[model samples]
Target: MSYHNKVVLVTGGGTGIGRATALLLAERGAIVAVNYSRSAAEAEETVQAIQQFGGQAIAIRADVSSNEEVVTMIKHIVKRFGTIDYLVNNASITRYIAMEDLDAVTEEAWDDLFAVNVKGMFNCARAAAPYLKAGKGAIVNVGSIAGMTGKGSSLPYAVSKAAVHGLTKSLAQALAPDVRVTGVAPGAVNTRWWAGKEEQMRALIRHLPLDRISAPEEIAALIAAVLEQPSMTGQILTIDNGQTL
Candidate 1:
């Protein structure tokens, strides 16, 4: 279907991969709701950029981990846009604790990670399911290569994304023939997500098959491509520069 005037919600659409996805989808004629948890300014910037490009967009501040907040956000979106055509669960969090550092991987840390990475996706999906089904829309979750390899910034993060992968499939099955659910597991990309790991990120880039980390736009394009496919559901596509290979 043509993206013209289609309504899409992108969680964590303030910066990084989420921001890129929001912009690209808006540019392609989709009316986007850019959701942000703490990056309100960044979300506003994204909305401005979309509007400047002659696309329809709005910046929404909502914590996906909160069911009440997610429900409210959905109500507002439907109130404003009339209906939702797509849902992109791009909100997530991670800890930089080394895998061997079990001491640092506290219960609180695990809780925080799963609350955002896994539960947040669930909250959003549950809230948006009806609207999506009404429009015969789809959901594209943002997962991580760590989920598949059981390797990432921390053990908890990897576990959370693995849950996301599982959730994607289960959700596809539950909401099937109506609102399709899928995901993309992207490896390291140069975004603000790597706050203090600049040197490490650079070092790792040399070892990637592509000789460079994936760009946010590149991943966003893949997300858009996935949304364009009608027969895909319950699948998680990887864009890791062959890092897992």
Candidate 2:
């Protein structure tokens, strides 16, 4: 669908893929609602950047893990924009513990990762379902290659992402015909999430077939393509610079 004048809600839109997607969509005439739970400053900066470019945008604060907050956020966006046309579930959290470090993978870590990564996506999709259905909009959930390879910064993180992939397919089937649901699984991008792990990232790049890491803008472009493709749904597209290979 054309992004012109569309209203899109992008969770965790302050930075990384979310920020890139929001900016790209706004450039295409989408009115973007940039949602952030903790990165208020970054969200505002994104909004400001959009406005400077003559695009309409707003920075909203909501913890996607909270169903109530997600519901409230959807209502607010609908009230302000008069309708909702698209939703991007991109908010996620991960612990940097080693996969083999079972002791480090505390109950709290699992709970925290799942709460924001998996359940958070669900909350956003569930709360926005009515409007999305009404508008015949689409939903794109950000997943990770870790879900497929079963390796990432932490075991809980990988599992949570796997749950996200599952949720994406289920929502695609459930929403059907009206709102298409899809997912993008990106391997590694240069985001704040990789801060302090530069050495690890460099080593990973050497192992990748492409010998490079993906940029947030590249993933954003893929997300836009997925949303625009009328014939696609219930698919998880991977853009990992051949990390899985």
Candidate 3:
């Protein structure tokens, strides 16, 4: 599908992959709604950058973990843009606890990660389904390689992403024929997500066949490709620089 004049809502669009996707889509003539729960400044910066480039965009604040907030966000986007064409479920949270540190994986940690990473995707998809179906749009949920590998920064984080992958497939079936649903499972990338964990990231890079980490722009390109592919759905594409291999 052509991105020209399309209305896309990208959750957690203030930074990282979300920001990159927002910028790239806007460049392609999509009216982007950059959503952020707390990173208001970054979201606004994304909007400003798009505007500077003669693209249309807006920075919206909403916590994807909140069903009410997600519903309201979708409503606001549709009301402003007159229609919704695409949705990017990219908001997620993770704890940096070791997988073996069961004691550190508190109930609160699991709840927090699942709430934002798994349930958040569901809330956004559920809220945006009608609008997407109406316009025959597509939804891309950002998953993680951790889901497939069963390993990541934390056990809860890995499990939550696994749930995200499952949700992506289920939503694809539920929203079929009208709206397409797909997922991108990316491994390590050069983003603030690796801040303070730089050592760990470097160690991981040494082990990758690509011998390098992915850039947010690279994943953003993959996401755009996934969104544009007319015959793809219920699939999780991985771009991990060979981390899993």
Q: TM-score of model 3 relative to the true fold?
A: 0.98
Model 2 clash tally?
0
Q: How high is the CA lDDT of each candidate model?
A: 0.94, 0.93, 0.93
The residue pairs found clashing in candidate 1 are: none
Model 3 residue runs over 4 Å out of place are none
Which RMSD values do the candidates have, in order? 0.9, 0.9, 0.9
Error of 1 at 185 (Å): 0.4
**What would the per-residue lDDT of candidate 2 be over residues 133-210, giving only the tens digit for each residue?**
998899999999999999998999999999999999999999999999999999999999888889989988889999
Error of 2 at 138 (Å): 0.5
Ten-residue region with minimum lDDT total, candidate 3: 1-10
Off by over 4 Å in 1: none
Candidate 1 weakest ten by summed lDDT: 188-197
Question: For candidate 2, what is the TM-score?
Answer: 0.98
Q: Of the candidates numbered 1 and 3, which has the greater lDDT value?
A: 1
